[model samples]
Target: MMTTIAAAVAAVALASCAGPGSAADDAGERTLTVYAAASLTGTFEQIAADFEAAHEGVSVELSFAGSSDLVAQIQQGAPADVLASADTANMDKLVDDGLLAGRPADFASNTLTIAVPPGNPAGIASLADLAGDDVQLVVCAPEVPCGAATERVEQAAGLTFAPVSEEQSVTDVLNKVTTGEADAGLVYVTDVRGAGDRVEGIEFPESGSAVNVYPIAALGGSEEPELAQEFIDAVLGADGQRVLTDAGFAAP
Candidate 1:
């Protein structure tokens, strides 16, 4: 009877030592790492939450950056289970390298817009206004998806802009405008919508010339390929699309 009581006491001691989120408790948990464009930050975070709620003992780790940067990271062997690029061009680089489990699915589309400080402080009313010498314009670098879209818009509008700063991601451009570091910045329509009242978005007709199509796929080297594919499916599903459209992204 003493031996039995001692064993029970030992078991209780061990149980008490096992705290919440301890290695033992998390040993069964699976983590899915996703590398996506910066513009998809808010929407993807929301989707990640929903996905975790649906799958027991699953957590999503998201890395957001410029499409070009994300592709480069994956090419350098980053441990990402999924890749969601803001443009087909960046996604194609991975496809050419055979780094994707399958063909990427186009999920959503977005267009460029001018984001100015609240109340249009610089009075940037159109794409042409961004080119004025007195206006401080910020834009994404040419290698990034948003920058490529900006170039297309410039071509369609037959204008040129000398940006005071060139950022690597659309989020950086938006940040500059919102922080008053720039008079205006070229960012995605969805980014402007996400910014809410922090910045005022200016819609121009030329934005239609360069609608960026977003694509998502599971990586070929993922250890959790099934889970990665499931996450992609979730993003393409109706509820995910609803979250995206609500954030100002268009259907692909």
Candidate 2:
């Protein structure tokens, strides 16, 4: 009788361990990966937090880098459910390559600004000041969105600069200014906002001619298309627009 009782308890324990609702099955929750431009980092991170709060059982994994680098990753078939570029040109490249699920949408826009150290020690005030031999400048690589916008603004102002460094992202350009590595750097207006008291933003009239439009879309071959689409919608919705606007991004 004792042996039979022990066998019965062991069998029940084993059954519970092998039940239909086991831990292994519960681990099937979905995780969505999003690759986005570096400039969108702060705002997108807040958006992701809000999204996770509203959607249970879903996780958003965000990767932030230069728009061009993100585009290259997507083209190389990185496992991303969504891609957001700081400019439409890179997005068009992905779309042309047939890597996006549908047409990309312009979610936000921004213009270039000259970011300077907290006090503007160089007595810099305008675009032409950047060309002074004594003033060191940092700029994004021409291949990146912010760099391209800077180039356009420079051309519009008929000015030239010899930057001390060509950074890979707008954030890097801002960092160079904030750290005093360079007297001035060309960066997105949103980045200037993000920097807050760490740096000061100087407005240049030529920046208006070089507005940058940020585009986002669901990637092709995504495992969670529906969720990806939902994320895209959220980014374009009222709440998302407010976040972008508050971060100094302009309407498309």
Candidate 3:
């Protein structure tokens, strides 16, 4: 039985089919549910497919959302086999609550960057350019991992931006830029790379000041503990590293 989070903050769930063992449900199938940060959507989806292939009778269910939101759902008793956070801070909340089956492992790291619409519509060349009132800047909320990184970058660069909008996830911010809803948006380097040509990315030195490390672990309340550990292992393995690295994520 798969239990979902509240409809108000519903998460996007994707399922991948494969094979399972003795742990399979009465219907001869086992579902491994993973809650991951939005930034990890592309890479994690690839990893999930590989995992499903390696473990036959298994269907991997992936839910993507902000790191904070995912943690809240897990804390509220959402059913998940594994949890992969975009930043350690949100994962620490679960640790403090003793909601993890074991120690979390650092897998990848990412840094923030400026994303502008194609043709550099706003001419956002540097971090300081986003501070101008003429630029419609969008960014993740301060509570999000990307937002926290943006705050650090602001301090490091000694510049403040009056964002036109604050989104809940990096993808949302990226979407605004792609759709021309905002002149530019602050998102992760990987997010910009994943967007293909929909948005153009601008790198700034201050982004290095706030690199976010990605972590993964098994949830304490997981029904498929062994399966969860296996998935975590897959994420920490060489194939996983290659996938993440190719997706613009730096190794942790």
Candidate 4:
């Protein structure tokens, strides 16, 4: 009987040495990485903060860049749990390549604007003003969503602009205007809002012809599919839509 009791005691000691709830705790704490377009930085950061506050034992890591660049990274097999593109074309490309888990939903929309330094130092007023010899224009490259939208607007307006630089992202275009690198730039209304008094947004009627829609989805190889879906839902749900709308994004 003493031997049997000692054996039971040994089993208890072994169990104690195994560490209580260590495995389960480790499993609960996971990091979810999200790749999103640069223009969504302000809005998504707020969403990420809200998500982390609501979820216990979970952390979010965000990587923001141009939508085209983000898509290329995902195609190259970068580790990303979620992807939010500024335009549907790049997301559609991923869907066509079978890289995404499901159909991407249009989460939000934005329109292009001409951003200039506060007080309109160059006396620029409209789209035609950008074509003046004295106006130095900064625009996004054709590969980026904002650039493509700008192209459509320009074409629709039958206007030609000799841009001083073709930036990689819309934020870069805004930066040029804020820093006085250019007299004006074609950027999104959301970007202008995010600039926070750094630049003034000019809305042109031609911009209505080329509104950009943002789409988001979970990647097929995401390590945290559940978290990715949660983020996507927050972007499409009422609260998320409110945030986007407050930031100058149009409803999808």
Each prediction's RMSD over C-alphas, in Å, is 3.0, 2.4, 10.9, 3.7
Off by over 4 Å in 3: 1-26
Off by over 4 Å in 2: 1-26
Sort all candidates by TM-score, best to worst.
Answer: 2, 1, 4, 3
- Give me the overall lDDT of model 3: 0.92
Per-residue CA lDDT of model 4 for 1-252, tens digit only, reads 999999999988876566656553675588889999999999999988988888888898999988999999999989998999999998988999999988899999999998999998998999999989888999999999999998999999998989999988888888889999999999999888889889898889999999999999999999889888998888888888988999999987
Please give the lDDT score at residue 141 for candidate 1. Answer: 100
TM-score of 3: 0.90
Residue pairs with clashing backbones, model 1: none
Residue range 181-234, candidate 3, lDDT tens digits: 999999999999999999999999888899999999999988899999999989
On a 0 to 100 scale, what is the lDDT of residue 192 in model 4?
88
Give me the runs in candidate 1 sitting further than 4 Å from their true place.
Answer: 1-25
TM-score of each: 0.92, 0.93, 0.90, 0.90
Q: Which model is ahead, 1 or 4, in terms of TM-score?
A: 1
Cα lDDT over the full model 4: 0.90
For all candidates in order, the CA lDDT equals 0.95, 0.91, 0.92, 0.90
Best candidate per TM-score, number?
2
Question: For candidate 1, lDDT tens digit of each residue in 46-86?
Answer: 99999999998999999999999999999998899999999
Model 3, residue pairs in steric clash: 19-56, 19-57, 19-58, 20-56, 20-57, 20-58
